[model samples]
Target: MTATVAATKAYDISGNVLKEDLRDIIYDISPMDTIFMTRAGRGTAKSTTHEWLTDTLAAVNAKNAAIEGDAFGAVARTLPSRLKNYTQIARKDFEVTGTAQKTSNAGMRELMAYHTAQASKEIKRDMEAGLLSDEPASAGTSVSARVAAGAEAWIYAPNHISVNQSAATTTAPVSGFATSPVTDGTATAFTSAGLNSMLQQAWSMGGEVDTILVGPTLYNTISAFTGIATRFRDVGSRQQAQIIGAADVYVSAFGSHNIVLSRWARATTVFCLDMSTWEVAYLRPFQTVDIAKVGDAERKALLAEYTLVAKSPMANTKATSMS
Candidate 1:
């Protein structure tokens, strides 16, 4: 129906007065899962360079008959070796202008508080990346920032296995720091056999494997392995049947492992970890502080000083350089 030629309509009015139709809720879909960080143990660190000691028992001998109690010979004793990693600082900061803070917002009531929370989450994500990265430890000079060795740097030969690695590229770090494995830029498909090999290596070293951490791609890849059975649920007439398509727990000869997926994990690497063998040493736990005001703005900083401790690197195994 058309309006009459002389009739006034709402569209004919200039600058119509109407309240905004914005919804009060805000939507965010960013992932914030830090599986490794959440599962690892926590400890306090007193100094910037945190240190821990590890010892190993002597190898077993098949022939130990000492002439049936002949003259007793003293055997040399071995001492525990000390391992150290420098603490790294991770931080995030945000500022909310005085005017913005006072404005009525649709999503959040307090601007500064919202930004502070966001900064905290961002720092956590940064730490997760740092802990899982292949970066080596460095006692930084005046010009560089100190770096803590990650799990990849500490995991060496006998525990660090790989698929399709170049010759002599997979070098173990000296004393669990200061070096990292070199990649061949080649990617190979992840296999159950490769994972089993890593698990076996750790088990042989007296490791009590309990968790298998992987990236999204490998997580899906493992779910499709033939070893994982197709799971079904029995339901009543009023219920819907459920089909479990993903493998959450993997059972092997070594042990049962809880498979954990991490968005921040390296796509080409998988860690078979005994959670007890690892720790995060924190010199300064995560905290927020207000910065000195220079203008009409409020600023805040979120930070933590932490380092990864491979209490017993041999107690963990990893498979790297895979697709």
Candidate 2:
């Protein structure tokens, strides 16, 4: 009644298997909310054109009225000036090979989810960099031409006040709309008094600078400023030595400003902005496209066509050339 040896033996062909739960986790630290340009201004692009125009006017000055029964004196009519800037569209594409996904056996609904997020992050990173450029795009082989008329390209409009304590050389001004460039400072550090002075200057020009954008070093320096002291008392029965520290708002002679720590900001420069006067114009909102199939398993691209329109540099001033 015994069975054959072959019938009793079972072949182990498929090896040990473990459940493959795909936890597609991404650990890249990207600039998620660096859209400072759109934070304080209107973000509407009505036209489908590649370039957008903004009308500007100089501050109306107060003048003495004509004397009663005196000869009629004439005043110049205030005309609106136009500022033209080109829109920039950035794209990022990614493709996955057919075999790569086929061989990898994992419980995943979408294979291209990670790639899409990466492409979107990169496009946004580049946009933040472009927004902080010192020179607006010029008419060249690669860049667009300067804005028409006397308007400074958006880049030139921001305050570029140099605070170099050393003998810094000056460079030719890029446009009549921009300030002349100065060499970096040889000084060691930035002082609180210096920041106060800059704020005062902007205040004198009727600018309510409500935001102070600074780099890491400057942010740390400001946080440690003696002028910004914290005096709070804990009234619990069991008092714990909790170190509560943060410098969110800075009160200056001009106005109170929120602090923004930026890693993308240029070295030796700090921007003080009113926020109400800045704008981001978008010809086309961000979109993803599926190109015609050529040879890839799956392909997609992300795009954002946008431009920065600074309403007036007078509303924003920067302290530059500080070490």
Scored by lDDT, the top model is 1
lDDT of each: 0.82, 0.60
**Window of ten residues with lowest summed lDDT in model 1:** 164-173
TM values, all candidates: 0.91, 0.74
**After superposition, candidate 2 runs with Cα above 4 Å error:** 1-24, 29-31, 35-38, 46-66, 99-108, 140-158, 164-188, 229-241
Clashing pairs in 1: none
Tens-digit per-residue lDDT, 152-221, candidate 2: 2232322444454654333323332233433444654677777786677667666788878877778777
Q: Tens digits of per-residue lDDT for model 1 on 1-323?
A: 97799987666664576456799877888788877888899999999989899888888888866676689879889999888899999988788899999999998999888888788878888899889888889889999999998887777776778654543134655764646644534567888888888889999888999988888889888887755544445789998778797888888888788888888878878889999988999999999878999799998888899999999888888777677
Provide backbone clash counts, one per model: 0, 2
Displacement of the residue 96 alpha carbon in candidate 2, Å: 1.8
Show the lowest summed lDDT stretch of 10 residues, model 2: 146-155
Q: For model 2, what is the error of residue 252's alpha carbon versus the real structure, in angstroms, after optimal superposition? A: 0.8
